[model samples]
Target: KEKVQAETFIKLVLLYNYRVERIKQFTNVTMGASTKEADIIVYNDDTCTKPHIVIECKNETISELEFLQAINQASAYAYALSGTIKYIWITTKSKNEYFLIDKDNNIKQSIPDIPQFGINKIQKYKYVYGGREQNQEAKKDKIKQQFFELETISEKDLINRFKQAHNSLWEGGKLDPSEAFDELDKLIFCKIWDEKIPRQKGEPYNFQIFKEPLPKNATKEQLLDIENKQTNDLFNRIITLYNQGKKEDPEVFKDNIRLSPQKVKTVVTYLESINLNITDLDSKGKAFETFMGSYFRGDFGQFFTPRNIVKFIVNSLPIDYKDKVLDTSCGSGGFLLYALNKIRLKADVFYKKDEIKHYKYWHDFASNNLFGIEISEKIARTAKMNMILHEAGHTNVISSDGLLQDIEIQKNSGNKEFKYNHFDYIITNPPFGSNVKQSEKPYLENYILGHKNINWLDPSKNECRDNQSTEILFIEQCYNFLKVGGILAIVLPDGILTNSSLQYVRNNIENWFRIIAIVSMPQTAFSPTGAGVKSSVMFLRKWNIQTTDKYKLIKQTLQEQIKKESCLKRKNRVSARSIEQPYPRDAFSN
Candidate 1:
C-alpha cells in the first residue's frame, strides 16, 4: 500500500514537470540529533538546489489520527531540510491534503489540495450578483461591494430585520400570530430560492427579492409600474420553485404565498440581502429555533424542545446508517433531524463520495427510514419544512394523532402494517401532564401497563393499573414500536421516575426492557416554554422473548401449585366433615 502511494506521489510530481527524488535518508546536521526521512522530495533542478516541495505518503486506510501524525512528521522534515520548502503535500492512495508555509516557518493555512506545477488551478470563490452586470469584471466589482454590504450588517441586524417584517404582519392586524409566521416562512423560502437559482445573463441586476430598487431614470408612475411588476415577477418565480419542491417532497410545503404587493415588498426588503443556504446548519437551526421560541411560547410551547437537550439526547444514542428511526411525537422534527445529521456524519467517513448515491443516501433515508408522527397540522407542516431545509425530505412524517396510530398498529398485527416493532430506535419528548383516561377501557385493553394482568413469573398477583398519564402511556408506546434489541430514548417527568406511587410503572418497565441509562435534566429544561416541571431523559433496550421466558415458566409453576393446594384443601374438608353431619356451610363455601 505504501509502495503504491509512493508511486502515485512520484507520478504526480513528474506530471507537474518538477524533478523528483525518493529521499531515503537525511543526515543529522548536529551531533546527538536524530535524522529525518520523507517519502519523496521535488526540487527545481537535479542538483536539489532548493527543495521546492516535500511529500509524505501513507497507506490508503490511514485513520484521521494517523494522518495528523503524518502531518507533524512532514512538517518536521520540511523545517529540517537545508532549503525552505515552498509547500508540503501529504498523500494516501485515495486522498491528499496540502498546507502552505508562512514567513515564520509554520503551517499557515491548508488549501483544497496541492496545485499542479504550472497550471495553478486553485482559485478563491466569490458571491456572484444577479442582473446584466454579470461579466467577470463587473462581478469582481460587485464582490467588493458585497463585502462592504456584509461587513456593515451583523447577524443580529439580520434577525431583527426578519422580526421586523414578521412583526409588521401581526402588529397591524394584517395577520394573526400563526398567519404571520406562515407568511414569514414563505418569504424566507423565497429568499433562499433566490440565492440558489441564478438569474439569466444580460438581465439587469435586480435586488428586488430583498428590496425593490428604484429605476434610475423614470417618472413616478413608471417607477411604480416597474417596481410592482418586478416584485410580482420575483414572487411568481418563487412560487414556481415551491411547486417544484412539492413534487420532490409533497409533505414539505403548503399553500402558495398570498401576500399583497406591499406585504411582499416589506418581507423581501427585510430578508433580501442575506443568504440562508451559505450559513452553517447549526447556526441556522439555533437562530431559527430561538426566533421560533418566542412565537411558539404559548400555544406551541409543548412542541418546542430546546436544541441543547435535543442534541444531548440524540448524541447519547448509538445510531446506524440503515437503522429505522422514529420520533413518534416529533415536535418540529428536532430529534429526527439530529438523528439524520448524526447518521450522515458516520456516512461521511464510512463511504467515499463517488460510492454514495445522493438521492438514496439522503432523500430515501429520510423518506423511508426516518419517521415522525406529529398531531398538530400546523406544527407538522413546520416539521416537514424544517426537514426539507436540512436536506432531509419529510416524506414519512404523518400528521395525525400518535395514540390513534398506535391503536391502529395494535388492531392490525400484519407485518405490512409497518407500524409497531419496526423501528430500530425511538427517540421522543412526548407531551406530559395530560390524561389518557378519557378512553380508559380501550387503553387498558390495548396497553400492557394499562391492564391488570398476571405476573410473568408468578400469576398470583394482579399487575395492572388504570388512569395512566399520557407520558406513562408513551413509555409503553415507545416500547411497542421498538423491535427486540431496539433502543428507546425518551424524556419524561421526574415524578414518574421517583414518586413511590409510580413504582408499578418501573416494575412494568423492567419486565419489558433493560434500563440502559437515565439522565436527570434540570428543572428548567423546559422552563423557556413556561414548563418548570423537572424531567429526565431515559434510555432503554427492548427485551426479547428469550430474556422473559424464565419468568414466564416460574409463573406457570406457581399458578399450578396454587391450584393443587386449593383442590387438596377442599377434598380434605369435604371427606372429613360432610359425611358426619350436614357440613357447616362455611366449610362448603371454603
Candidate 2:
C-alpha cells in the first residue's frame, strides 16, 4: 500500500531547508517521451515550471529492485521536462539518493546529497535512519569536497588493477582464454551499471563484492567460499540490471555472464574498489586498452592499433554530428570512441551553457549513428564494453567478419540496417601482414577482389581466387559500406601502395575512390602490436557516379580537340585508357 503522498516526503525533505514556495507536486506534466505523472517537481523560482530538482517518492520499505526502477523513472521524468533541471532526487522516509545532470546530459548518480537553496551550496544529510540534518554550512562543504574526491582514482593504478585482474584469470585454469575475457567483460559491464543504480539504505554498493570485511585469519578455503558467494550475488544483481537495461533499450548489452563461481571470484577481488563508469575517459581507455593489448597480441595484434595513430587519423577527418560513422574491423573500438569524443567537443563549444538541451543529439548519435564490426567474439565484447564506457551503446557492433557482411545480414534478416550502404564514414586498421587466408566459399564469392579476375567490371567471371588476405578484401568492403561521396580513413600496408604485384588493389581503389591524402605512419607505430610493417593512413572519398557525367562531358571536349589538332592530339588518341587515366589526376587533387 502507498503509505505517504509524494508531498509528504518533500515537506519532510526539501521544505526542511529549501524555500517552500519553490517546490510543487505538479500534476500531469507532459514534457518527456511519454505522458506520465511526475511525483514531485521542484522549481528554482515561483514560476514552478522552471524545474530545478525533480523527486520521485516511494514508501520507505521498498525493495532494492523497485528502488532502482524508480530511479530510471525519475531519470526519464527529468529528461522529459524542460532542460533546466540540474538535479534529480529519489527519497523515502528511510532512503535518500541524489544525482547531478551535467551540461551534456550525463547523469552522474549517487552524489553525496542534494544541492542547497543557493547556487553551489550542497545540502548534507546523514543517510542514517532517524538521524537529524547537519546545520553547519561548513560541514556541508566538507562532505561536498569528499564527494568530489571520489573520482580521483589514479590512471596508472587503474591500469595496473585491470592488469592484475586479467592476470588472475589467465593464471588460473578456470576458463579458456577467450572465455575468460568475455566473462570478465560481463562483470565489468555489470560493475558500471551497479554504480549508477540506486540501492536500499542497508544494501551494499553494487560493485563492492563483499558485504562485510573478511577476517584476516580466514583460511584459503574460507576466503574462497566468501569470494564465491559474493561474486555470485554480485553477478546475479548485474544480470537483473542488465536485463532491465536491455528492456529499456533493446540493444544495450548482447551476451549473458557465463563465468564459473570460482573464476568470477578471482576477477571481482581485483576490481572491487575501481569504478569503471566514473573514471576519466582517457584513464578508462588507457586501462582497458592496456589490458586488451596484453591479451590480443601475437595472433590478433592488428586489433590493438596504437591510440595515438587512431587519434591522428580521426582528427584528420572532418566529422560532424550528422554523419553516421563505422569501423568495419573495429578491434576494441578506438576509432568510434575518438569520433564520439569529437562530436562531444563540438557540442561543448557550440551549445556552451545550454549544451544539456542538445545533449540528447550527441547521445543519440553515439548509440544509434556510430557503428562497428569485429570478427573475434572476445574482442567484439571488449569493443562493446569500451563503447559503453564512452557513453555509447554497442548494439551496432556486429561480431562477424568484416567481409561476411552480406551473409550476416541475410541471417539477421530482422535487423534491416545490418546490411551494407548505411554508413557515411569508415575508419579502420585492418589485419595486415598476418597472411590469414579466407577459404569459405560463400564469403569468398561476395568479395570483388577475392577473385583473380583483373577486371571487376567483367561480371561474367565467377572464378574465386585462392588465398586472399582479409586486409585486401576489407578495402572493397569499406567501399561497399560508404554512401556516395562518403569518406574513408584506413590504415594500409606500404606494400599495397608501392608493390607492383598489388597494383591491382590500388587500381580497384583508384576506380572506386578519389584519394584525398596519404600520410605515412612510422614503422614503429604498430610495433607494439607485433606489426613492424610499414603502413600509412589514407584519406579518400568514394567517387560519386554523378561526377562521371561531368567526366563524360570532358571526354567529349577532349575528343573534339583531338579532331581539331590532328598533329598534336593524334599521338594521344581518344581511347578508354586516354579518357579515364588523365582526367582523374588533373580533376582531383593529390
- Which one is best on TM-score? 2
C-alpha positional error of residue 450 in candidate 2 after TM-score superposition, expressed in Å: 2.8
lDDT of 1 by residue, 46-83 (tens): 56657656778877545545766988888777777766
* Per-candidate count of clashing residue pairs (backbone under 3 Å): 7, 1
Displacement of residue 39 (Cα, Å) in model 1 is 60
The digit string of per-residue lDDT tens for model 2 on 1-590 reads 14445545455354345666776764466754457887777787776768888788876445545766888888877776775888887764344556765535343433445565554644232222112222332345533311111223667667665655555565555456666666677777766776666653433454443332345456556655664665577667656866766666454356666655555655554555456666876678777777777777745676888878998999988899889898988988989988988888887777763567567767888878888888777787788888887777678876776676655754753354655676789999888854435554467766778767656545356677766877888899898889889999999989889999887688678777889999998879888778789999889898776664565566567756776788556656666467777665457665
For model 1, the stretches where C-alpha displacement exceeds 4 angstroms are: 1-133, 137-161, 172-174, 193-241, 256-258, 347-368, 406-418, 437-445, 452-467, 552-590
* Residue 306 shift from truth in candidate 2, angstroms: 0.9
For residue 533, give model 2's deviation from the true position in Å.
Answer: 1.8
TM-score of each: 0.60, 0.62
Please report how far candidate 1 places residue 54 from its true position, in Å.
Answer: 56
Q: Which run of 10 residues does model 2 get worst, by summed lDDT?
A: 125-134
Candidate 1, residue 165: CA error in Å?
A: 3.5
- 175, model 2: CA deviation in Å? 5.6
Give the TM-score (vs. native) of candidate 1. Answer: 0.60
